[model samples]
Each structure stands twice: as structure tokens, then as C-alpha cells.
Target: MGDNTLALAGGNDKKWSDITSQESTDINTPVSFADTKVKNVIGYDNNTETNVRVATIEDYENLRDATNREFAYGVLYGDGATETMESIEDVYEYYRIENGGRGYPESNRGMRGCFVFNTENGNNLFFPIGATGYGQRRTEHAWYGETQLGAGRLQYAWRNEEYKKKDELGYRPLFLDVYRRPGAIYWVRTIPTNPTNKNKKYCFLDINYFTFDFSPGETEPTLGTGTSACFIRCVEEIP
Candidate 1:
């Protein structure tokens, strides 16, 4: 059961034609970029003007608390979504998890996990650093468990990287959904884990707002991390 897309030995090979009975990707291809463009929809006017919204206090907090750089984030913003939490974080392990490097090269941090801001403490460190299965009745297995890496202490598996390959673009994506809002202004962070190491620097986003758009369950999985990744103070007007 490998991710046939990259020949990875885990995800299964489910043919697209088998599922849709189509031989070509013509139907799947988007015909018009303008049709999917986010314009006045999020607060945009026409092509020349925009009605961008100002940032609010909560927006600021969410921005400060979120990670500016991105390793693996949700394609959308909900549960059971296409690019869910479990799936996106895998993006981190591939690029950042090279041998003897900045990431968990020693694989000590555990398995496919995530980091998110929890509170606004004075020192600003109320983040969740445990398993993706914190509490409640939810739990999940690593995308590439012992199947990929040896069965080391998998308890803290959430902390370590997940893949051993790169994405389609060679470089990982920085923002999760930065282009959601056309006129509304909101952003997270992209702090470098090692300020001195420029190559390992990455972006972490804190907020996402899509005024007139609807992704439904697109963002569920990426956000399904065991804990909250952003502080998300508000979702309303700035003033």
C-alpha cells in the first residue's frame, strides 16, 4: 500500500480511472483560473480595486501564535477533508527530515505529528507538543509507521517527520490557504527554527479567511491535528 504517485511503499494504488471510469484527466482539469479566482468574493472589488479588511486583535494573536513556515498543512480547513491534518504534515518529514539534519534526523521526536499555539501566556509557550491523539475518542496510525521507519518508540511519533521524499514542486508550500480572502488581510508566521540556517527556514501561517468561498470538508484533515495549530482570536470585522 504505497503512495503510487511517488512510489512510496505505504499508500495504496487506487486508479483514478477505476474510481471515475474516465481514461483521461481532461474532466478533472480546471478550464478557467478566473472561475476559481478569489476576488471581491473575499472582499475584492473588481480586478483593479480591493476592499481589504484590516486586522483585528484576535487576528494579530492568531498570527503571532501560528507558524509562519509550512511543512504540511491542510489544503482546505475542516475534518475528513481531502488534504487533512494527517496527510499535510507528511510534507514536513520529506524536506526537513533529511539524514543528520535540522529535523528529527535521529527520529527522536516521534512520528507524523504537528505543533500549534494553545494560549497567549506571558512568555508565549502554551503550545501542544504531544501525540496527535491528545484526548477524546479519536486516534490514528502513522502514515508511514514501522513500515517505513524502524519501530522505535512510536509513542511520540507525532513530533517527528513522516516522509522520505519531496513534493511535486520540489519545494514545500509555505502558506496553507493564504489566498483565501481577496480583500481581507490576515497572515501567520514563517519563523526559521534555526535562525542561522537559511536553508531550513520555513513559513507558518496563523489565520485563514475566505469571505464568499466554500471548501466544505477540504480543510478538515489538515486541521485534525491532535491539538489546535493556531490561536485564531476572531473571525469578524477589525473595527
Candidate 2:
């Protein structure tokens, strides 16, 4: 069963036929992104204003330690109840162009600049890497288990050249979420081992106290991976 979306093998397809042939799926079963909503919903965006509750380094660290998953801030302008789009570019734009480049008030960061301050030491911070487009297409194709470059057809705003310049100057910021409902599946930055594989990865924060990954279970048993319309929720980091 290949991923029909990219006309390539799916993740599950490869899972059954292991390269090492050891059936390693059970080796390290991934834990879901834990569900721990920090009370960082700072404010509501009327137009382009970012309204995220700032989390201290302690706050975030505590959350990560407790859940084993990092916290994702909310980009407040999009329709939280639904997905931005099926295409990665469209989803990225929802936060970049539509959300005013995540432009927030200086008060949020005490005039230094927008940042996810590392509360542990209280001296470190990071900028948003951009909304990762887990959706990928083969810019070129190769056999299974081989390395191939696939253009995800998406670009993160933080990776933009201008943003890079600003980052050099220290005006860096971080990223966040989509979906209004607690248990609804939303997009996060992730994909399976093979880019050409169609069984794309998605995420959700269950109200039951854990965050988990999801994907299209099975394709048509066809030769290629399956592509389905999905949702988007951005992520940010330091390293």
C-alpha cells in the first residue's frame, strides 16, 4: 500500500517491509504530543495584532517536563475552528501574510523583541522557524529507502531572507496553533520517514491529557501514496 498522493510508497507500506528487516515499529513507539494548554492566550487579535499569552522559561520547561512535548503558541488571527488550507504554502501564508507576520506588541516581550524566552536560565530565547508543511511532493523520485529531495512546496516565514537579517539583529520570534475545539486534529510540523510516502503525519491535543499523531490509515492499496486535505498549526523552537 503506497501513498497515492505522491505516487510513492506510504509510511505503513515501508513499516511492514523493514530495511533492517527487524520489524522495528514497536522499538520506539512515539508518544503523543501531550495536552497541556498553558494559559498563554495573551489577547485577542482584532486585525493583525498577535494575542498570545507569554510563557516564562519556567512555565514552558515545566510543561515540557510534564508532557514530554514542547508547547506551541497560538497565532491568533486564523479561524481556529478549522484548517487554513490543504496546500502547505496556503497554510504558511495564513500565518505570515494573513496574520501580519506574527507581528505583536512590544509589551509582550518587554521591548526587547518577540521571543520564546527560555525560562529555565532566563537568558535564552528562539525565533519561529515557520509553519512546517508536512505535505511533500517528489521534486525528483528514487527507489524505496533511498534518499531523494522533495519540494514540500512551502516556505516558512521565519526562514525568509529578511527575517534572517532581523534575526541577526535580534528581533526574533516563535510559532503556534490552529483548531478551536479541544480534541480536533490540527497540523503540526511532521512527516513520515519517506518524503514521497503519502501517509502524511498530523497532530492533535486530546482533552484527555495527551497530544498524539495521526495520519491517513490506509490508501487504496494502489501503487502510490494517498493525499488528503488536512489542517495546519505552526511550531517554534530554539535549537
Candidate 3:
């Protein structure tokens, strides 16, 4: 009758014996369960059969709500390939379904809304700017280019000499893993406060050949062709 105890149903002697012998725990020992509800817990990689302490969509949203920055996650098309705004919306909608179908609202605790970056980030950012989302607009109009670099995400991926713990990166002022291919170029919305060209509206971060390079005056944003995708993981003021 215990939560972790699974009683053998009507099964043959051999199969039941095999399953129970390995999975069964001592009733008297009292197995320790997760502190929170199993469903509430994050970082469960079923494939790996281990908990990966990577940031979930909820983590991204929490970071966004607390700090007004948009934690964009997607593959930006750069190399000659092009996609429209509608396509991006489709991709985002698919992403929502994949990440647990619009998780319980932080305020309501269970109400689900078609929450978008505009709703969380508090800006009508999904407008026609060729492609991309509201983070670009918010970065341009407000925040004034105070976004964190993509390298900021990697800071938590491993335990370095400075950060002995993996979770330690989460405590930093701004932590995000706008994960993408190493060689692919990614977009950074921070418009140069003093750009060489005043007409340029967007800037980009190039992560290729094991080097981090920032390029100003990117009139057009692209994430290459095929599976090469870009992510927009930035930081904002912690509200």
C-alpha cells in the first residue's frame, strides 16, 4: 500500500519474480521520496535515466519574469536560408507543447494561457521585423544593450575552478543557456549604443572556430541553413 511499493498483479511466477526482485525495496527500510511532488521536479531526462540540471522552460520563464529580459530559445536561420515570422510562431507553438503545454501560471498556480514572450517580457515584441521575436524590440527600445553574452550559459554547464558547483551559475546575476551549435552564428539584440553606422539596428555574436566574436552593424539576421539554429538567451533587470 506504500507509494513506492508496486504489488504484483496477475502475472506468471517467472516474470513477476524477475521484476520484483530488482525493483522491490525493503518495506521496513522506508524509501526516501522526492522532497517535492515528482511532477513538480525539473530536469528529468527519461532517455538518460538521470536528472539533468539544465534550465527548463519554467526556469527560463522565472528568469524572465524576475528579470525583464527575454530568454529566447530557437534556431535562427543565418546561412542563406530564410524563414518568415509565421513560421517562427509555428515553431514557438510547437515548442510550447513540447515543454509541457503551457505550464501552470506562476500567479494562478494552474491556469494556462497561451503565454508568449510579449506577455512574460511585457512587450509586443512579435511584430513584423522580417523575422524573430520581441526580445529584439525590447533590447532595442529599452534595456539599452545590457544583455548577457552566450558564453554566460556555458558558465554553468560544467564545474570550473571558480565555480565548484553546477548550480552555482544559477545564482549569478544573469544565467542562460541559449544553446546552439558551436560553429553556428547567433543573434544578440544589443544595438551598439555608439555604432559605427547609425542606420544599423541589430548586432550579432559569432561563435565559430572556438572563438567568441561580436559584430556590430548586422542589418540582416540569419542562422544559416538546415539544422543550424540560433537562440536568444539574454538577461534583464531582476524585478
Report the C-alpha lDDT of model 3 over 72-144, residue by residue, as the tens digit.
3233322223443344343322221124533322221111111225435476221111122212211111111
Worst 10 residues of 3 by lDDT: 134-143
Sliding window of 10 residues with minimal summed lDDT for model 2? 106-115
Which has the better lDDT: candidate 1, or candidate 3? 3
**Per-residue lDDT of 88 in model 3:** 33
Q: Which candidate is the best by TM-score?
A: 3
Regions more than 4 Å wrong, model 1: 1-37, 42-62, 65-194, 203-239
| Local distance difference test, candidate 1 | 0.26
TM-scores of all candidate predictions against the true structure: 0.18, 0.19, 0.21
Tens digits of lDDT, candidate 2, 152-180? 22221112122234434452332122111
**TM-score-based ranking:** 3, 2, 1
> Which stretches of candidate 3 lie above 4 Å from their native place?
1-182, 190-194, 210-217, 221-229
Task: Report lDDT (Cα) of residue 192, candidate 2.
Answer: 29
Q: Which ten residues in a row have the lowest lDDT in candidate 1?
A: 213-222
Q: CA shift at 25, candidate 3, in angstroms? A: 64
